[model samples]
Target: MNPRALRAAGPAILIVAAALTTIAALAYGGAADPLATGDPGPFVRWGLPMAKLLVNVSAAVMAGSLVLALFALKAGDREFDGALDVSSIGAAVFTVASGAVGFLTFLDSFNPELSAGPEFGAQLGRFLTEVELGRTWLMTMIAAAVVTILTFAVRSWTATLLTAILALVSLIPMATQGHSGELASHDATVTALSLHVVGAAVWLGGLVLLVVLRPVLDARRVPDVLRRYSSIALVAFVVVALSGFARTLSAISAWEQLATPYGGILCLKVAALVLMGLLGAWYRRLLIGRIDSANAARAAKAGRAFWTLIAVELAFMGIASGAAAALARTPPPATETPYSSTPAEVLTDEPLPPELTFDRWFTTWDVDLLWAFVAAAGIVFYLAGVIRMRRRGDRWPVYRTVLWVLGMLTLFWVTSGPVNAYQDYLFSLHMLGHMLLTMGIPLLLVPGAPITLALRAIEKRDDGTRGGREWIMWAVHSPFARVVTHPLVAAGIFVGSLWVFYFTDLFRWSLYDHLGHVWMVTHFLISGFLFVMSLTGIDPLPYRMPYPGRLVTLIAVMAMHAFFGVAMMMQSGLMVAEWFGAMGRTWGPTPMEDQYIGGGVAWSIGEIPTLITAIVVAVQWSRSDERQQRRSDRHADRTDDAELEAYNARLARIAERDEAADKAAR
Candidate 1:
């Protein structure tokens, strides 16, 4: 196919392939078949997934375009505007499709009679307002509508970035309401699905953006944009692959299940994804560089090959996308165990873990896929930065690297190990995890100076587009960052969060909602990091408290920390009685005893890190003083004690004046 014609027909090819595949998969899996009892009819059943397919594709286009625009295209350029226009169009479709899906979901779920009657309208209203699934779609629609407007209005770098964020967030509601939510491992599945959706969107939508931009881009600019996009796609590929694997694990328990209809469809999707990955590798290694060949014919030939491959890539993406939609409607092979009326199962959506034991503390592992990914990415990126610095003959500290790795590992353990496994059952374990997250992890990470390393390691981009380094620098110097990273403010948030989280419904929210749980973890980590940075960070901050002032702040926070723990210890009534108190635990201490133990953990174990931070501060203060003395000695050595001589001369002059005045008075 002619490259120009292929580029023009790219989206059409994708949509057609996706539509055809969806119909076939639905037929194979019997997802859109008439229900045994409360069938919403063939139209509603078929239309729903088709609408969902539109939602997925449009959302990808919206998010992926904005991201590529930010990273690859210069602001105020025609290509940048075109990208936003594409994103806006995608968002508009997303909004309409989300609404359609919402309505279809109501029909499919409640099978309400189609009528203009008040009763029908009332039922629809109730469904939209009261039902979890209904509310999710409603929220998604609203977010999509908002994104539609933002993408159209935003032309600047900052505005486009914010719009891109909102576009990504709109997918979360969909992620939360999917089949993943019904799984035994609800949190893991939800996290995996969310990551999968976003990653796939970026990968697919970025390709779409490149195709749309190809006709407009000059030959010389093609390779650079493609090169940047390939990097984005590469990262997206990793995320999609990992998250898809996780989702697969959650959905299919046995190898034999792979033979089932749902698993067969999954295999098809996996095959498409694998082919795309290979295509990505092929072009990235060979074709992308050739597209910029100085010889015009060579460049055009490479461009044609690249664009044709991209078209094929889009078709595969469509196949994967269609299979995903079908999988959502298709039941997984693993039979879900019916939840008993056990309080633990009722709250957590899973059976109670075996009773806690000393050995189990180390052996027990309920991995939080989200945090596991985060820790892995953190270590990988940090090491990558170190390597980059070393390659450039820049000397990055080995100790800093070690500390960062240790910090990330500790974070992984706190989030995914025994603490995470038992936290839902044991208050003590939760508190232990919290302390490590807020105090211990930050203590190690602050010394690593990741921000400082990144500044040095990431090559500055001269192009108008914002890359990783540009964005990082902007965030560090942003007004909000300045306020939050203030010594006093960071200290306040660090100490105050302890009281606010436990004493309020926020703790209960974290217990019930995976989103809330992630928010809690993020909040603690950031607040702790800021406080530690103010105290002993090697990274540059806008403001740093004087060493004495830092010590004072630390002491005050420590006092509050101890008092918060004591308050927890003294609680006559359990906090979030419906949650922590009603966990139906049998192996651990009584709820009250466990609560007391939790308080003890906060008062004792939590303070160990604080004391260590204090000791670090003290040692830093001594070193600072020693450095100042050495500087003074060096200055004196250079000036031959000029300052001391000046001081002595001034004293002698004062004495002489005083003696002369006394003699005149006598």
Candidate 2:
């Protein structure tokens, strides 16, 4: 079909699907008895019966269509082929469904009986309370549809630019709307939700397109296309997984909830995700290898198997999305109750007025002395390793090993001392510890190329078949390798964990308990590693990004961080440790001092790493361009030389002809 016809089909199908879903939802709601209501539930009181049905059905349809689109992408067929047509239908259906859901919600806002529950009176009142979330999700689905359509028609740059704008627009409801009483009432939910929706769309949409449309494309170019998408998919998976985990942990409060029905559902979702990860690994290992070897039959077989696994994964993802919708309406477990403990209890029954303390690092003698020693030792070891390595060149034997050991020792010291001490107060010191462990330390260690160095060190110590050498290779080549490297999965984990910690009662719980601290520390380290690996060319992970694409990814991340910081600053209530008030640390130009500082960290200091990343990408791009230019210049010079030789021969032939004519005349 012509491009114009194809474009028309996309929007036209979407409009029809939306209209049908709206009609279906209205019919469904009308069929149910209006008074057939259950007990006044905490969340159900927030909306009308019809509104609820409409929203749920619309959400389901959108989510289901998203799954279809993801499967389509994975199918790997031609852009305008039958698979593409099917995927376009799915996109259109999701768009309409989302629109119907959003419109019904707006309509429900006008009904006086919608929020007539004893808990929260009036529909407007309840919606005002929960409008932020409604707006967030509604905006998200709409934006996803638009971006998906754009991806089919526009160039990557244009589509990406539009997607970014849409992402910003989707953040509005989250920022302005109040949270459910069960969850944190602060504005972090806005940032968290924004990340969640955008991450999910990019991940699911990319996969759908790849699955459905990849196969029908030019057969000879399939490997390159797959490789390109694989890299993108890996990043998308990482973002989705990290962000999802962050949101979950931030919302969940009590450890006991893990055994509850709500927690059980969450666990099931996680298990499904794990299974999906396994399927993805199989594809990378079996199918990708075959495609690389130009084995068309095996590649096709692997493709079919991959689609089956993706279909299963999508079903589970739908379950998870549905559960998420339910969870939004359900009160988080009782354990999530915020500020449950009295101020007196938190302050150890002290009747002292809160006082602000800054630059008090030296007050804690034990921590101070330990950190000092650690600093001194780290400096000494670092210098020693540098000197030794510089002298020995690439053959430097024990220096790299010594450096790695010293780094590990430093990490332990930082975590055990300052990290532990800060856990006691849950103050700025604790946040400092978090940054050190997650962002600062990882930055230093990753660039040191520890994995590569460790691999070489093992090879030197063993006969290559035994010890750590074999183990390193095994791990890199293992199924887990692809799971962690999947773009959607890893990104989900990285971004999700951050949301989970701050938004849930888990924040306070972690501050109160040792185990909570441990969990936080573990998650922080893991997430940091995954994020850095995705963005930076560090580990031997089987993914690489084109320069332009990497720049766009970096921009998207920066926008997210900036949005988070600004949103936090605008919040009226405290979102961090409540005991911050008890500790006198709450004093500043305003209560938002910490948030402002956080934003500063995100905006100013965050740019340092990003700048470094940009430079690296720029260097690579320039080097590639330089090589290409040199080749072109050499070829052009050769062509010019040949032309000059031809011209000279022609002149010589003319002269010979003239001489022959002169001889004949004589």
Candidate 3:
């Protein structure tokens, strides 16, 4: 296929492939089989999944195009504009597809009569207004519509990035709707599904956009673009593979269940995904370089091979999409028991954990896949940067690397180890995790100076496109960063969040909603990091407090922290009584007693990190003064003590004047 022909036929190929595969998969799996009672007919049963498949493909294109444009293409170029146009068109399709899915879902769910009458309209309205599934689709449709406009109108970097984020957020509603939220390990299921959807979209959509933009890309830029896209696809492959596996575990409990229809569809999806991954590795390793070879004949041959393989990859992606949609309709073998059996289960959707003991503290593990991924990525990227610098014979300190690695490890343990495992059941453990997230983690990470390392290690991009280094520099100097990193503002947020989060409904929200919990963790982590950065970070910042001022700020915040803990200790009524008070644990301290212990943990253990920070500030202060004195001595030595000579000459002149005045008086 030539570039022009591929550009003309790319989207058609993907859509046709997906549509045909979805129909075949649905028929084979009997996913669209008529219900024994109250069937919504073939149209609704079949149309729902078709619409859903369209939603998936369209969303991927929208998000993938924007992301690729941001990272790979230079701004103000035809290729960049073309990518955004593709994204806008994709968003429009996404909006329509989401609406179709919504209406079809209502039909499949309620089997409402097909009518134009007010009664039918009223029922439909109620579904959209009142039902959770209906609301989800409706929100998705609205968000997609908004994204469509934003993508079309915005061409600037910041605006387009925000639009892409909005586009990604639009997928969350869809991710939460499909069997994920009502299952065992609901939190993990939801997180995995969300990541899977986003990752798949980026991978699939970027490929489609590349095919479509082939004519627009300059011949010289092809290799670079291909390499960049290959990098993105590699990361997406990892995310999709891992999250898909996690989602699979949630659906199929036993290995033998692979013979079931649901499992069969899942297996097919897995095969397609794995095959696509292999194809990616092959091309990324071999074809990307050859496509831009010095030999014209070789370049032409490699280009032809690459484009042909892309068409094949699109077909495989279609198969995977079809199987996924079918699996959503098929009932899973692993259904969780009802949460109504116990108060703790009802509240958390999981049973109470084993009793909190010294041994359990070390042995218990409840991995949060999201944070684990974050920590892993952090460590990997940091190490890669350090390695890059080392290979170039640029010295990056070993201590910084060690601090960064240890910081990431600590973060993993705090979020995924025993603290996370029992935080919900025991107030004290939750407090312990909170302190670690806010203070302990930041203290370790701030000294690592990741920003400084990135600035020194990551290569600069001369192209208008933004890469890791560009983005890091932008973020560090961005106006919002300046505000947040200011010593006083950082201090205010650090101390103020403690009071505001605990006293308001925010704490309760965090206890109930996974989104809220994630937000709480992110907010506290960033706030603490900013505070520490102001005090002792080696990273460049807009402002830093004097050492004495830093100590004073720390002391003031410590006092407030202690006071807050004391208040918690003195509480007569339990906080979030409906949640913590209702957990029916057989072997733990009473709710009130646990709360008191939590207060003590916050007051005493939390303050230890603050004290350490204060000490660091004092140490830095002493070193700063010593450096100033050394500089002064070096200046005096270089000039033969010129300052002292000038002072002595002035004293001598004064004494001579005084003697002359005494002689005149005599």
User: What are the models' TM-scores?
Assistant: 0.97, 0.43, 0.96
Instruction: Give the range of the ten consecutive residues with the poorest summed lDDT in model 3.
Output: 177-186
What are the per-model numbers of colliding residue pairs? 0, 69, 0
289-387 per-residue lDDT for model 2 (tens digits): 675565667766765555555555455454444444434434345433334255634443222223334433323222222233344544554455456
**How displaced is residue 520 in candidate 3, in Å?**
1.1
Better of 1 and 2 by lDDT: 1
| CA RMSD of all predictions | 1.7, 17.4, 1.8
Model 3, residue 504: distance off in Å is: 1.4
Task: For residues 269-328, write the lDDT of model 1, one tens digit per residue.
Answer: 999999999999999999988877888898778878888898899899999999988887
Model 3 spans with C-alpha error above 4 angstroms: 179-185, 654-666
Better of 2 and 3 by lDDT: 3
lDDT per residue as tens, model 3, 1-666: 787887777677777877787787778777789889999999988888888888899999999999899889987889998999999999999999999988988888889889999999999999998987788888999999999999889888889889989988888877775542232336787788888999999999999899989887899999989999999999999999998998888789999888877778889899999999999999999999998799999999999999888888888898898787777777777766744688888888888887878997788887878888889989998999999898999998888888888989998998889998888888898999999989999998998899998998877888678887898888888899899899889989998999999999999998997778889889999999999889988899988778888988899989998998898899999989899988998788998999999999999999999999999999999999999999999999999999999999999999999999999999
Q: Over the full model, what C-alpha lDDT does candidate 3 score relative to the true structure?
A: 0.88
Q: Which has the greatest lDDT?
A: 1
